[model samples]
Target chain A: MASIVWLAPAVTPATEAGDDPLLPPFGAELIVDFDLALSPYSEGSDDQQEVFRAFALGLHAGRRWHRWGVGLAVEGTLWRTLDGRGEDDWFGALHTGLEGSVLSAGGRIRTRVGGGLALLLEGTALDSAGGAGFYVDLRPAGLRWALDDAVVGFDPLTLFMTLPDAGGIPLVDVQYRLCIYAEFGR
Target chain B: MSARTYPLLLAALGLMTLPAAAHGYSLQTAVSDSCHERITVSSLDVLLDLVDDVSGFEVPDDPLLRQLLGRLQFPGTEDASLQVRFVMFSIIIGVRSPDTDGHSTFNLAALRRLHADPAPRGQYAHALRGPGDDGIAGDLAAVDGTIAAILDEVQTGASLSAGGVIADKPAYLDHYGVVDVPVALFAWHVGRALHALQDAHAHMIWDAEVEHIVGVLNYIDAVEGRLEDADGLAHSDALDDCHRDDVAPLVEAATRRTRALTLAIVEAARTRDGAALRAGLAPCVDDATDRDACGWIVYNPPCRAAIRAGDTDAVEAVCCDDANDFCGSPYAAIARQEAVGPYLGCATAPAGQSGGWAWGLGLLGLAWLGRRRRFAAPTALALLALARPAVAAEADEAADAADAPPRLSVVVEGHGSALDDRVDAAILSPAFGYGVRAGWQTGRWRFGLHVDRDYWVSVEYGARVDGGVLDVAAFAEGLFFDDYVRVAFALGTSTLMFDTELHSTGNTGVFSEIRPLGLRFPLGERLWLVLDPFTTTVVMPAIELDDRLPSLRKVQHRTIVGIEGGFL
Candidate 1:
């Protein structure tokens, strides 16, 4: 027999209160993530290195069947530093994509690994002029903890972020994110 | 795009796709469940279980899927796989439902044609338009007609006979179609119809502000009578007249009507009575209350009025004022003030700069104080270790208590990083910072206090104020993947010296920081090099400073690396 404990079946307001108690199979998540990327190789960097920081706020809704879940997410990323070449020009990206996750949990912690394809609705830092393109992302590491009434987690290693905003710019960016989510209904 | 367009887009999207709507409406799953339960209790689950086991048409336990498939006639043949029937079921239900763009899968015209000719091909005509100025006449009609048609065909057997809700024979067992069983078919049509009704309710109550998270809180508060003001509709030039707190009654009315219609349909299907079926559906058509309540006309009028006015300025003003109200709201007045303060710049205070902090230290302090009193495990562990030699002398005594619990371990960590103090211009040039973390852990979970102090390694105090920043945070850390990785978030206060011409303010600000990526490389027993490569901090002041001063309130982000170890 598999013994299951319905942790926070009603409310766990560690961070913020008024979250729905029932862990509905289908949910909408509002995530505010801080993305820090270090590109060892870049287009026009003299030092052969670029450090970028961005604040990504995304809205995603999906249905979960057991451990596997699939959904669509639209992320609006505001880049604080792009290219890191003293350009001082900030950029923004709107990434709309299909995201899939496989999650497993033990005790109060749940670990998830997710990846998907994203359409860059906006542009990259190098373009200076914003544009859109396609990219593939892989998050090998993601973890969620039951924090009070809300669930908080982050995808640490988001690799192969090739939004390809501008032509002839071969760049690879790795992203890290911190997210807080609340489940609405069952 | 104009700011006005954003709110309108949100409003439209919120009304269309209630499932994905950000506002905290709990009706989506409620309606979905009520529809599913109606069939599950009517022997639909038993039939599904048998079909799943025999014909391999099994699907996962999903609420929305269950509702959609509840009315499906399971094909008892190898040709119709689970995927095939599932897709067919989705096509039948999805065509009438709202999509992400707030449009139905099929338009009223196409749905009417599909209802006239029951087939799967016509279910794919993408509806580009939603309800018009007066609402679509044929949209709900076609849905009802199709539902009735399917239920009528499902009840059609070799001969119309009465007994135990069609348990005598299974009409769908031989045919590869959707309309065969009374239980399954009734569940499906009723579920779909109920979803439509609930969707209609979503549009009526979801005011302008229900577009985002803060707006959702306001809507919930308003509905619960916590807020005395009229709903967000009052602020909207479009929906001001529709503002009311009668959402409960409206929803209750709709729910009762839909449930009654479902039960009546089930009874008619059981007896194979065609007239009773039509009579059951009469409420959906003739009953003025249900019809009026379950139509988008409630929103279309005001929405069209706003659309015709084309008053972008008015829309923006309302949206901005709503944003202001959300910021000034009692619930959001605490942790969210710093975040919303900048957006409220158009209303209050200048748009230049705004800075404030949250006193997360008090919360952290309380937790630490509580932890100190609750956990005597550390002291007990020390005593146990000291008494090990004496206990070893008495073998019998030691053997009696052999099943002892694991000892709690104390962890301490410290690291250094480089900082770019952009806010204090040239005040802390070439800054370097160090952080320390101390906690007690038993197994995978750890609770601790983290302190980080940033000072100018090389300072040139040339008219620029230079002072060290001290940050104190409390966090919960969890080790996973066989203890190879750890993740943690810290909530605390950042005390920084704000040197202005008038006063020297060493203010404490609130912050929530997370180290999402931490990998442990063990160098020796009980010692590990815990490399946290990526750490981000969200900083704000605990107390509000004078907004008349320069806008010092800006969201701060930093990246730091640290090393940690554990010693019991």
Candidate 2:
């Protein structure tokens, strides 16, 4: 007497969430992210800080499980960069990817993981401090000689847990982290 | 007989004065109380002797039997002697924290509930209730007369883990019965906890905690008259020799085991060693109320509030102290409030804040006008028929009725590498890898573990430029979402130590995943997106890649930071 249909959620009879074509197409989310990384490279100064900033914009195709759903948006960040010698330096890399989640249950909980080519923009500002730099002087060299790989962790996509406008810096140290996570994909 | 040889000690201690023939009810109370502490291998041996004469049961030999039986040869099982042991175990698993006024109040509440509501309450009792409630029913599946309810809370199955269903399993099955479910589930968890030990990381449970587990299990065997009765299990005839010569000894051994470990637990707890507590009580910390018993019940109003605010100092103040306080035991819900909070940050938002799309859809259906309207009744009925999807989706979210899943899972992932070196002494072609995942699922939540393995392809120390291998990897992640807000936590293993002159050590520096929040409108045919903005954290692992293995060329570690987009 009771039935469970998977496609029944986002569609009237067949369409899924995020698959909708008409509803105001997903808006591009311009993410201006800044990250301060401490290389676990013991051979080098463990305290060596690696600061990076990037802007990417991309939207995803819409999805619908049982009812009417929304599509994903693709966004690319502006000019991504890093901090060298305690000063903000230009990031000679390009980043592009996708993000979205399920529209069921009154809210949306996202699970996002994406990657793209990161090549040096060729010309960038010089590091005034003499601490650490990329492409020309200190760390590594060129776009191919630059840092490349997919870096990932959880990103709060909804307002309930999002940080309030604060960015570029954090409120605490490494000890602030508690959870243990893993990443893998060849 | 083992019992006859130990009568002097039992009698000397006044424990043998009771009529040994009818000690069922009495021994049950005694052993149950005694089981609350740290049990050791040596103490458990003697516990078997105490229960040797009981007639109805026999010792069981499970997959973990030999390991458990090997532990029961010690002495001591008095209630007072084992109290400390039980409390310590309670604390590690988030059950009986010192915060509940120095008592395993949650467990105590369970005892009260068991005593208070002995009658069956149907499946409703298994629903995911809050603290102090025994969501798992007492009647676990019977696999040869042994207690297996412990598996009811497992959340480690494959589908369960991907779906984040392990955390909710135990509470869901509070009404039904799953014989091997609990054991299989806990086994995976304990294995994962143990793996953490090898990684030199801190978690809910550790390897050192083993000394205490064997102790409690030993006590259980001793009190239960474990195995002796098995060989002699010839209730078929009166004087079967297997009953006398074979089974009796096993029974005695099991009884003694229970007594010894109970005493050991008590001793360890008195010393207040963090490791000892971890080993002694991590098992019972399976539920929210169990969190109370484990003494993880954090009552510091300000500390708790600060934890919510993501205050670092407050987290340190409350969690750093590993003594016999409310949060001293790693078992309390409060203990994980910060560091692991996001993963455990469950969502309980109300439905239809803006009213379900059902209303809008409903209005659209009413606007129809046709001659089929002549049979308006049938049209209305058909519209309602189409309403099943909306209603079912809402109902599934609410879980209006009963019954949930009993999940079990096992996983193993590994990676190997190669490297090379040149005249520049620059390393080329290097690699490293490690992966271990396991979980248990029960009801709507899933509890799981993700272990990380590091594989450095090679390390090339060059004169001109210095850069090595790096693997952008994720170590662990916990997520909960199904028509609700989901908290996803990830641990990134970003190692750039093996930086060699070789090809490239994959270091996806940007570790990020999307956590959904707010009401979501269905995205497309098979997807959805949270309607609001969310937050996330990024991390770079502290891996030292200076050491190189014998068989490789250069440091080679290439991997993704984490996965995002679509259902995984």
Candidate 3:
């Protein structure tokens, strides 16, 4: 009885402190993106070329890139071109080299034009397919036009259309994309 | 043709005489009105079949007879309609259709020049004339046993496997031959048969089979969840085919043998204790792959006890099959992970693709026939429906959607092809369009729309010839049924159109679709699987030139029965 009474104080409400607000919805969410497309690809050649009709899906779990995060993307090609005789095959590649996007005028200045590394592996099952590639990407912040989500129309929402459009701003030729991330973290 | 052959000729005529509309057969009137040319051509087919039948009976050797009979034999489950056509095609073409086109000609001169003095063609006559044994009871028993064994295997392994293979354990480490085949082959067949059974009305009678599989899912899922909760284990290596195929999973859990991710169950089994084995599952739940595994397992002693007591039902209900695990919502994230990174292109190839073994042989035989003769005349001339009929077929034109305007869509689908281990450049092609789509969103209703289109402007299909070749095109039409996806059957037609040149044959090869009934699964908002069992009936315009060689500009009917899916 005595020990129970002695321990009661620690468990009592009087010792309680105020709340801690450390848990969620406030941190900057780091973001990474990858391209996941399989195809009888069109609008591209038999070589290692990136076809635009294809789009990207979230892949390889989201990785935060606000810190020192860099990405290398590689895409391979498989092709079997058919003429009267039979099949002639080739490959292609599209990649980039740079750091995140920048804040520039000229529509985010579409900074960091790309040059990707490539190789051609051949044989058959009669077609070209997987290839190896590596590249770096960078985009900067800039102001531009965008549609406001709330308005659901061309409300001319303000956008940070930087070279590497990461915040709901539109950019071109993304190594898939790394735009606005929807997360609980900041 | 002689009077003796007239009976068969009449029977053939009768079979073809079904009201074309009942089978949804149409006269394809849009092609030039080449009716007379068609009659002459069909009569020729009948005459050829009769001659071939007679020629077969002329053979005296038993061995040759048996071999031929085997070729013509129709095992149950195979489409008999196609079997009958094979006989007809073999008779008319002498070789196979494809062969006739490329290598062999079916003319008398060619037949006379052939090496064999007497082809054992009569073998089919003997087989077809033979009586069938209706041992329904015996067949039922066998089927029952096969189905039971299959279910038992699946039931035993469903707990042990993830997508037919044991989740991440190197296979070759254990007894290779014994373990692998059972898990892989047995489970695969069970799953396959389950699908087949569902397709063939088993859901109405044997719902238990489905229930059993779904029922057993609890324990396995429980274990999986626990394992996941634990800091993920290190045993995530893809097992070889052998290990993945059989009861190694049962053996692993039952024995607790671990050169890989063996459970701690067998340790208990050694003590003559199922309790230990039951407890062994705790590792999966409580002490799974990583830290999370420990959390789920460390606290669930009662659940472990329930499993140990051999009370699968209790363990299932208590641990899994609850709102958290059973409805498949909790693991959507994990499932997505598995779905995403499927090692690019090195996965095992799908069966019956491009021209697998049986198809290869079938095609080879067909190509042989194509090289041989003028089998095309009948298909080329079957155009009589465009004109006056001696017997008016009633079913035709009655079900016409002419008054019903269908909402049409033209889809340009692009998909990647695999060549061995590599993926190829995406190929984009526009599929022909035609369908009547109707959508009702809650209270909002949209007008019904009917749509249709040929693959290309021309109605001709897959025409091949000397110097001039027409491309093959795809077309589709939709038919809708009410409510419930399964209850609602979507009716549709696919047409492949192309053109070819034949001087003597009369350029009447129009609307010859080389495709058959197919099913597909949608992958994305617009993507879907397209699986079709292909069968084609060739139609053409017939211009009477001469009932001879050049007039036989050979028609080759091509059919591909296959399953192609993934991202439409």
Candidate 4:
């Protein structure tokens, strides 16, 4: 008698289950960042300090649980003097951090805050030129818009502080990123 | 509010707010101009002094001076325009003059060699002892060879002026329709010869103590990823900046060598005696060997007498100890190395003719791609057939249209850089380009192949060289708003070619283009006009002068307009 009675399984829609159609739980991003560094301890005349500019291209991967997310980012940055002097410096870094959506609008727009710590390795001819350092990348605010499987993000002002070896004073830089993420596994 | 327009707007706004600055050296006219000024001033002094010493008058009107000047076709000192023209002609033929980045003129082609030789012979007249080197003898021989080449060119020009049958003129002369081709040609060769001799003084270290040129700095090494191996005392800009306090001595030395070489060249031209040219270049040679040898024997006349008496022990005792002591200093060691074998000034052999051949093959491939239009129809039909199935279901829904949505289209585009004010005006301008794209469209997606050519002109040192960029890419586009708006992204490789006399050489790099806001307007049933407001192409490992000049990388942005015609 118990085996004869068959029951149907319950079905639930993704929206009803509090899942966002745009802000995917697992996704990857392609990022382009422009960095401007203020090296207070650089070699230059009294009136001027050697300004450094870097162009970075990167990949980011993360998994999200509701409003909180954890991610790992890897990027290669090409560094050069703003005045076009000397040779170019290249560096690669791996960043791991946590990000959370502070505000969301209709599951289409989200404002995020994130901070990451990175270990940077120099990739240049001169050994120890820009010594291997640890970087603290803090995004106090960022805005992202979702479009189906893609998300466009802009971090207007990101702060980077590098703590070099030998306990030297930290090197500070300001950066902005234009990111496009092709989301999957929503 | 379409997905296509949203990302496009965001990309455009982001690009607009990005900061940019000029990223390379200016045309480097300062270095070339300074070279010309030094040569002119020094030649005048040497000629005036020679004439005065011979005729007891402070004038350059002596018969010898006049004959030499007339034969060399030396321009009047006060005629600035003529002098500039003379220098320009010289630079055109003497150095590989068409580098857009200005390294050729700045380094005076010192990084390049006459041939792919492993020896320490640079385009600079300065030669160091190396494999296949004969020391000062080799240096003198190189100088003689350059002089011979110059005289040969002058003779050819003279013959041409005299209505002699010459089959071909120099390629560089095509742009300059000079009235006196003979004088222009002579000045050209002289300018070429003078550049090397002058560079010897600038590039080589002067030993004031021994009054001899000791060592030559290798600029090619300094800038070419071997900075650690390079001499710290000298760099690419060390002697180039004539006003630098440390460079004053080098300039003075260059002036002295310039005077010696000019006098010798003039004397040789007057007498047609090649020996006189060699003797003149001897003064410019590294005399460290003789100077070092004399240091031991001169003070100890007994050592000289012992050598005359064939007393080997006495000679070795006084001279060998002194030689060892002298070699203790790094400069003396370099000087000693110069006496025995090759010193460090020579750059390694260049990439050689293989690069030129590869460039030629690429050009031919591009030409084949351009000429084989007959294959376009079949290729388009094949692509359309492959794409038809994917859009077949959508096509069944729209039976009213004459043609299916999955049709092949060919687009021709004209574009120009939008970075005129954003980059260094001297280094780059808003150059124009043209391209073609062929693709198959299905539903809201299109995929295609694109070929583009952008022509750029580099003007420097009063000479112009044409350069170009050839881009070939594969792109994927998304159509939105009933196919009125489009956003396309492409990844491609670009080749930047410089049209120089030796060979067309260039750098090749990978690039990606994002056409953010492209509007397609219907002109007819099967034709449309495409306008892109912002297209950004970022080339990585950027295009620059050859590996010799590695620091210059440029990123270009452009706006594109095109016309597309559907087929099949």
Error of 2 at B68 (Å): 49
TM-score (all chains, Cα) for each model: 0.27, 0.21, 0.18, 0.36
Estimate, for each residue in A1-186, the C-alpha lDDT of model 1 and write its tens digit: 000111121122222111122133223243332333332111111111233344556666555444444445556665433221235434456555555554432212222333333223333322323333444444544445544444555444343343323222111222333333443323
Q: Which ranges in model 4 have alpha carbons more than 4 Å from their true place?
A: A1-60, A63-182, B1-119, B122-186, B209-211, B220-241, B244-250, B266-271, B283-568
Best candidate, lDDT: 4
lDDT per residue for candidate 2 within B164-273, as digits (tens), equals 11221111000011001112222223222211111111111111221110000011112112212211110111111112342232223223323322332233323333
The TM-score between candidate 2 and the true structure equals: 0.21
State the C-alpha lDDT per candidate.
0.34, 0.23, 0.22, 0.38
lDDT of 3 by residue, B1-568 (tens): 0001123322532211111000000011112221111221233232223322221222222332223333433223144343233332222221111111111111111111121112211101100000111111111222233334323433443333223231111111000000011112212222222221121111011111111111111111111122222211111111111122232332222111111111121122123333432332233452344421121112133443565576766655544222333234322222222111111112212332311332344356457655954333222122311211111122122112212322332233222111111112111111222222233222111222222232322211111122212222233322211100000112222222332222322244343332211222333322223322211222233233432212211121121111212120
Predicted candidate 2: interface RMSD?
27.7
lDDT tens digits, residue span A3-106, model 4: 01100000111121111232352233322222222212122111123433445555555444443343444445444321213233344443333333322211
Candidate 3 lDDT over A110-140, as tens digits, reads 1122222322233223112222222222222
What shift in Å separates residue B556 of candidate 2 from its native position after superposition?
13
Q: Candidate 2 regions off by >4 Å?
A: A1-52, A55-87, A91-186, B1-402, B413-434, B440-449, B458-479, B482-568
Clashing pairs in 4: B129-B341, B129-B342, B130-B342
